[model samples]
Target: MDRLIQILKDPLLIAALAILVLLGAGELLSPGFARGDQIVRLLTVAAILGIVAAGQNLVVLGGREGIDLSVGAVISLGAVIAGNVMSGNDAAILPAVAAAAGAGFLVGIVNGLGVTVVRIPPLVMTLGMMGVLQGALVVLSRGVPSGNAAPALMAFVNQPFVLGIPGILFVWAAIAVLMAFVLRRTAFGWSIYAIGSNERAAVLTGLAAGRIRTILYGLSGLFAGVTGVCVIGYTGNSFISVGDQYVLPSVIAVVIGGTSLAGGSGSYTGTILGAIALVLLQSVLTTLQMEFWSRQVIFGATLLVLMLLYGRQARLRV
Candidate 1:
C-alpha cells in the first residue's frame, strides 16, 4: 500500500497512468484505435508537439511567469522560411534548417530583452511578439502559402526508419534524452532551477538570472523553429497557420506533465508522457467526431483543472 501510494504521488507516474487510461478508453470506443500501428501514428503526431513543448518546458522552468506565447508564431515563421529555403531541394535541407533556427533564435533574443531589460512582463512581451511575427509572416507570404517540403524531408519525418518507428520519433527521443540530461546533470540546468525557485536568492548567490532567463527564451524560440521545420516536413507544405493550433497545446503539455506553473519542479519525462496522453485524448475525441470548438473547450478545461490540482502553489520570490 505504501509503495502504491508513493507511485501515485509521482507526477510522472500519474501521467503514465493517464496515457494508459486514455489508450484503454480509446480501444473501447474504437475497436482498432489501440492497435500498434495506430498508436505509432498517434505518437508521431505527439512527437511534433513534444518538440515544441521542449521549448515551452525550458521557459516555464525559468519562472518569472515565463511562458512563450510566440512559439506558435515562431513555428509558422520557421516553416515558411524553411519551405522557401528548401524549395523542394533535398541538398538545401541543411541550409533551410540553419535559416529557420537562426531566425527563431533572433526573435527569441528580442523577446528575452523585452522581458528582462525592458521589464515587460513575460506574458505581455511574448504575446506582443506573437503578433509581430504573425504580421511579418503575412507580409512575407503575401496571403498565400509558398514553398514545398523536400521529398526526403517528408520521408524522414513520416516513414519508418528503425524498428518500424517513424524517424521523427527518433528525433523526439534524442531531444528527450538531451533535455533530461541537461535538466539533471548540467550547471546551466541547475542555475535555471535556482533562479526559478528563488530569483532574489539565486542572484544574491551570483547566478546571472537575467542572462539565464534570456537564454531560456532564446532556446524556446530555437525549439519552435525546429518544430516548424518538422511541421512542414510532416504536412509536405507550408501554410500560414500550420503552427497556430500548437500554441496552447505546447503549454498544456508542459503543465500537465507536472511542470509547476509557479516554476522550478518538473521533468521532461513527465512532459513526454503528458504529450502522449494529450495526443491519445485528441485521437479519441477525433474518432468520436467531436467538433473543433468542443475539443478546444476540453483542452482548456483540462488545463484549468490540472493547474488547480498541481500548479496552484506559492509564487516564487522574485
Candidate 2:
C-alpha cells in the first residue's frame, strides 16, 4: 500500500478529497448541491480567495516568518477607493483599477521597507500595517462605505457568459498560470526559495535577499489589490469591514495547500485546491445552518490540526 499512502499524502489529492467529502455532505443536507448555478457560485468565491491567497503564499514563501496581515485591510481599502472612483461609470473602470492597485502597492512597499530597512519583525510590521489600514478605512468611509461597484466590475464579477462561466474565473486562471510559471521557472523565483530555505546561505551564494523579499511583499500587495477589485465586482458594494474576514483565511488556505509554515516549499496548484476545499466546507456548514461562532470554531480547529500535522512532519524530516 506504499503507492496508496503516497497518493493520500499528496497535498492536491488531500485537498480534492476534502472538497469531495464536503460536497457529499452538502448534497445530503441540501438538494441541488452541485447544480450548475451552485457550482459556478462556488467557483467564483473560491477564485477570489485564491487570488488573495496567492499573495499570502508568496510572502510566506519568502520565509523568515513572513506573513502579510495587511492583506485584508488593503482589500477593504482598495474596494472602497475603487468603488468611489468608478461611481458606477464604465469609462472610469481603468482609473478605478489603477487606484486600487496603487494603494495596495503602497502598503506593500511600506511593509517591505519596515521589514528590510527598519529591521522590524515581519509579524509586527504587517500587524501594524493592518491596524493602520483599518483605522484609515474607518476614517475615510466614516464608518460606512458609499458608492456602488462600477458597471464594468459588475459585468465581470456578476455576469456570466459562454456556458455560464464566470468572468472572474478567467481572471483567476490567468493569475494562477502566471504565478505558477514565475515560481517554477524564473530566476527571481529561485532566489525566493533559496532565501526562505536559508537566508545567510542565500546571501553567501550571491542572492539578493532583501530586494527579492521586498519585491515579494509588493507582489503580495498587488494580488491583494486585485482581490479587492474582484470583491467590488462580486459584492456590488464596499464596506469598512468588507475584507476583515479574509486575513486569517488567506494564511489558512496557503498552509492547508501543504506550504510549510517554515517556508521553502509550496505550489499554486495546491493552493487552488485548498481554496476550493475551504469554500466547499463553508458551503456544507452553511447548508447545515451552523452558527457563526460554530463555524469559526470549526475553522480554527481545522487550522490547528493542519498546523500540528505539518509541524510534526517538518520536524521529522529535519
Candidate 3:
C-alpha cells in the first residue's frame, strides 16, 4: 500500500495504474473468462487502439505545444480512398493501398508544415486541418464514401497465424517496440524528449528543434497513414466520418495511459495499457446490456474526475 500510494501520488503514474486495475479486474469477472477467444478479443481491441494511439503518441512526443487534431480526418480519408481501390477484385489492391498511404503521408506533411513553417499553434492548425481535410473529402466524395476494400490487405489484418496471432496485432506490437526503442535508445529519440521538455533549452544545446519537430510530425503522419490503411482493411469499405469519432478517444487514450499532457514524459506501454482499458469498458458495458448514451454520459463524467485529478501536469502550457 505504501509503495502503491507513493507511485500514484505522481499524477502520471496514477492515471496508468487506475486504468489497468479497473480493466484488469473486469477481465477477471467476465463470463467464461478462461476462454482463449475472450483473451484474443481483449488483446485485439488493445492492438487496434494501440495503433491509433501510436500515431497520436508521436504527436504528443513532438512537444513545442504539439497535438494532432487532424488524426481523425486522416484516418477517415484513408478509409474512403482505400475503398475506391478495391475494384471488387484482388489483383488491383496494391495500387489502392499505395494511394491510401500516399494520401495519408501528404496530409501528415501538410500538418507538419503548418506547425514548423507556418508557425501556427498546433491546436489551431490541426483544428483547421481537421476542417479542411473533411471539407476536401466531402467535396470529392459527394456525401457518400464508396470504395473497394482489398481482400489481401484484409487477410493480412485479420488472419491469424502461429497460435492465433492476428497479423495486425503483430504489426501494432512491432511498432510499439520499435517506437519505445527509438525514444529511449537513439539520439533522435533523445532530441524528441529534450525538445518536448524544453524547446528553448534544446535549441541552446544545439538541437534542431524545428527540423526535429517537422520530422516528428511527418513520422506521426506516416503512422496515421498506416493505421488508415489497416482501418480500410478492417472495415472493408469506406463510409462517411468512419474515423471521425476516434479523435478525442485517441487523445484520451494517451493521456489516460499516463503520458504527460505537458509532453516529453510518458511511455508507449502506458498508451497500450490505456487502450485495453477503453476496450474493456466497452465490452463490459455491452455484455451487461447498458445503453450506449448512458455509457457515454458515464464515460464523460469519469473522464472529468480523472482530468481534475491528474491533469495538473497540463499546467506546463504556460
Q: Which candidate is the best by lDDT?
A: 1
The digit string of per-residue lDDT tens for model 2 on 275-310 reads 888889888988889998898898888889888866
> What TM-score, over all chains together, does every model reach?
0.97, 0.96, 0.88
Worst 10 residues of 3 by lDDT: 309-318
Better of 1 and 3 by TM-score: 1
Encode model 3's per-residue lDDT on 54-112: one tens digit a residue.
86877787676678878888888877777776655678667766777688777777888
Clashing residue pairs, backbone N/CA/C < 3 A, model 3: 83-147, 83-148, 84-147
Residue ranges of candidate 3 with Cα displaced over 4 Å: 1-4, 9-30, 92-94, 311-314
Clashes of 1: 0
Q: Candidates' lDDT values, in order?
A: 0.91, 0.85, 0.74
TM-score of 3: 0.88
TM-score, cand. 1: 0.97
What is the alpha-carbon lDDT for the whole of candidate 3? 0.74
Ranking by TM-score: 1, 2, 3
* 52: Cα error in model 3, Å: 1.8
What order do candidates take by lDDT, descending?
1, 2, 3
